[model samples]
Target chain A: MGNSFFTPLSWNDTGFILTGVLNTVTISLVAIIVGTLLGLAVGFIRAEANRFTNILLGGVLDALRSVPLIIQLILFSTYVGAIGHPLDPFVTGSIVLSLYSMAFMSEVFRGGFESVHHSMATAARSLGMSYWQTVAYIRLPIGLRAVFPSWLGVALSVIKDSALVSVIGYMELLRTSEQLISRTQQPLEILIGVGLFYFIVSYPLSLYGRYIERKMAI
Target chain B: MEYEFHWIIVFQKLPQLLNGAFVTLHVSVLSMLIGITIAVLLAIMKMSKARIVSLPATLWVEIARNTPALFQIYMAYFGLGAFGIHLSPYAAVLSALVFVNAGYLTETFRGGFQAIPKTQYSASKSLGMNSVQIYRYIILPQMFRRIYHPMTNQFVWSILMSSLGILVGMDELSGETQRLQSLSFRTLEFFIVAAVMYFLITKLVLFSAALIARRVFRGDL
Candidate 1:
């Protein structure tokens, strides 16, 4: 018993944990950026689309949101491999995560675009502004400005959901901590650290969101 | 594109998959019920002026809202196990779902409650209604009306999130699919069925929610 060694987390593991943190942040940032762009484009097109077009598009996007994301990730990862076109875990994870985020982002953006009151657009049109001019001059600015809180909300959720990407073998923070916990046999300390990391990153953003929302309400 | 489809194994596994779906539904409904009860109390506490009362409520909401549900599950499972207080995979996932639902719903309820006018409360008092009568007859109904849509959304979310159970070896729909695929070497077919099952469950829920909303709100919604 005296000669036996207990494996504990050493200082060397700091670098390992940091890599996981960085990977998580990088994947989330990529998905959020790509998703927001696609969402903005799709949402705007949908907002301007006729009823038939809107339904056709909304049905597809709604289906994306209906399924669980973990299932989507696993299916996509395995399906791609099953077919003749296998991809890297990072590549597959980002692609599925981005598409998932886009599904939600498009809804948030659609609501934002629609919140540009009809009367305001009519006023713009009455003043001899073209349709494109009104969209640019009035609708775009007001809608985008008003949706900062919700956009931030989606972005934060994306950050949290990024943890699920680890399932596909992309080593995120949770995945890294799981390894450490298993090696050290100390789950509580490691899990608390992970929770604290997320809380620290997320709490400030949510506070900012609330602050912006309160200011806008006035 | 060269992979051949073999769906026969998936067909034979249908009964097990359905059982998994039932477990998924049962857990999510249980979580939502517990979550709603806690949310209602937390919402009230959040609005209270007492520091001790509001602080813990705020903390719970923030922690639940900010952390990943996956992390919460792990904490309940492995983290608690570290301390000699073990929870089953089902218990861990259920508790995690409830924690998140309550956090999000507290905010939703607060919004609903605040939407009721202050003048209405004073008016109710002048009309000879006590606090209990006022809340039971007036405030509660209006709050529920305002919160109904969001609550349905939360229910759908809980169902979706319960899929996280797969990670913890829980035999919910996703977990069951994982097991079936590993056995039959038919990952795509099994998961595709599971995905469709989830889609159906959520759609059924939304349809029923819509029907109930129409009846309860008398088409106002």
Candidate 2:
């Protein structure tokens, strides 16, 4: 049996783990940024005045949301490889994660956009602002703030769900910990350590989510 | 481009796939039932005024909620074996699902609990109802009503999340589909079928939950 309380973490090993952490964070951040933009566009498309456009965007979002992320990852990887693009696991995983996050984030932004008072948009238009300017100057800022809490929820979920990429050999934090545990045969220590790493990443976001909620409430 | 599609393989594997779907459904339903029980207890503990009780419950919820269900499953399956506690693959998946679901459900229930006005509890006390009576007759019913939609959403999520059980060799729907795909080498077909099955199951579960909610909260509707 291994030591229970104090299995030492070597600095060399910690460096490797930190690299995995960096990879995970980089993938998540890129996914979040791209996903949020795509989601905003889709959300606006769904909320567009044209009925056919609204249905098309709504259908796309529903299809994305209904499928499991792991399956989506595998499908994307296989299709990309078949097309000869042959992305590395990181790139493929980021694309999949971004697409997945876009579905949920679109819902969040849709709720946000809907919460913008109709009168405000009208007032902006009455002041001779173009349609684009009304949305950019008046609707988007307030709408995003209104949905900030929900966006935070989606962001936290994306961070946690990004762990699924390890299944496809992404070599992120979870995969690194799995490799370490297998080599060291210290499953508990490694699992707990990985859990702690996850906590460090997620707890701050959760606290910030609460802070946003409080600020919005005020 | 004369790629012949094989409906025969899908037909031949239907029985195995159905059996796997049954296992998936069984595990999800059982875990959800157990998880909700644990969640209710944890929610109550979280609401407790005592630091000792709330502290541990808070920690458990935070750890479970923040970590991926896949990791939790690995810990239950692989980590426990290091401590000489070995669970079957299905057992490990079930227990992990319960643990993870409990964390989310506790939050959902607590939200419901908080939504209840303090005056309602005070009024129950004023009517000379004991704590048990108040909880059973007053708080629980209303809490259930408020949490119904979220709980339904959670159930759908759990069903989809159960796909992870395939990683640990539980021959759930995803696992069976994966095997079929390997044999037939029809990746898109198998995945598209599996995705449709998942969508169907989720829609069925959501429809039933909506029906139940309508029955329970007809006046509110």
Candidate 3:
């Protein structure tokens, strides 16, 4: 078992696979950074906007949230390509990941904003702070700190979900592992390696999230 | 770019898409039922003081939560085959999802168990109930109530994640969409319709869960 699975593999083959890890990290970094920024903006709008706009945006965001990320990725990839606005798979994957992350992140951010006591906002107003000033100085710092764990959870999910880009033929870690398996016919070893790679990347984030939750509880 | 839109192909293919939706629902509901049963046991095991009892459950939840569901599905479908154990795409998706659903719900349910005051167990024991009776007659009912909403949310998650079955060539919603779009060359319309179908199914599941919760729990929950 060991000889068959382990013999044909060289460091060069492993190096090829590690390149997929680079793409995976790059895509996730872009998605998380852009998604969180957009999410915070949308969340702020949702939390503080007029009633009419809130209802409109809520309906749209909820619709986006309802569908699965894989479906969104496939649909977005195919739809854009068929419409003659052909995009590279990485572009489509990143766009879908960012959009999907934005939906959940917005909800998380909204919850964070809503959890802050209204009295704090009222006090800020009493001090003649402008709405923007109150948001920047009072609500954001407190709400962001409170939602850090939830945000971390979302970020971790984005990293994990980035694996689905392989479905669209984006040559990320999972896809690379799939190719490597076909070449080596050693599915067990290659997949375990892939899974362990993910675990290593994500487990620290999970631990940090638990740490943040513990600190916040105190 | 002037692109022609083909709404008619989507309307014509609605029946196939609906069949795929049923497949998606079947996989999700079955997985959730089995997953919850396993999750309850895992939660109990995790709460045990003995290392032999708790270690495995903790490791399962740790690995399951940190990894991607797609990887789990691939490993089940592809990795198991390496061991000469072949599973059909449907079976692979179901088993993988059951693993993941149980992993997530174990924590949710452990939290539920913790929410039940320790006094309830003592009270039940004082009434001459043994461990099994205390759990069955006292702990479980309240745990179910506490975790009902989150359980429903997980059900929705199961439904959504079943879309991953497409990668394994399972003829679920996304798979059917891919096949039909490639055949008709109506990629845009087919996928747009598929996305709408997914959106509707999820909303329906959420609404139905709410309705059932209202009826079953009545005023208590």
Clashing pairs in 3: none
How does model 3 fare in lDDT?
A: 0.90
Best by the lDDT measure: 1
- The two-chain DockQ for each candidate, comma-separated, is 0.86, 0.53, 0.75
User: Considering lDDT, where higher is better, how would the candidates rank from best to worst?
Assistant: 1, 3, 2
For candidate 3, lDDT tens digit of each residue in A1-218?
55554446668896889789999999999899989999999998898889999999988888778888887887788778766798998899989999889989999999889888899999999999998898999999999999999999999999999999888889999999888887777889989999999999999989999998998898
Return the candidate ranking by TM-score, descending: 1, 3, 2
Error of 3 at B172 (Å): 1.3
Which candidate wins on TM-score? 1
Those runs of model 3 whose alpha carbons end farther than 4 Å from true positions after fitting are A1-7, B123-138, B219-221
How far off is each candidate at the interface, as Cα RMSD in Å?
Answer: 0.8, 2.3, 1.2
Model 2's CAPRI class is medium
| Fraction of native contacts (fnat) of each candidate | 0.89, 0.53, 0.80
Residue pairs clashing, model 2: none
lDDT of 2 by residue, A121-152 (tens): 99999999999998999889999999888898
Question: What tens-digit string does per-residue lDDT give for candidate 3 at B1-221?
Answer: 67788799889989999999999999999999999999989998999999999999999999999999999999999999988999999999999999999999999999998988999988998999999999897888888888998888888889889999888899999888888888988877887888888899989988998888888779677
Tens-digit lDDT string for candidate 2 (B139-173): 98898888888878877787888888767777888
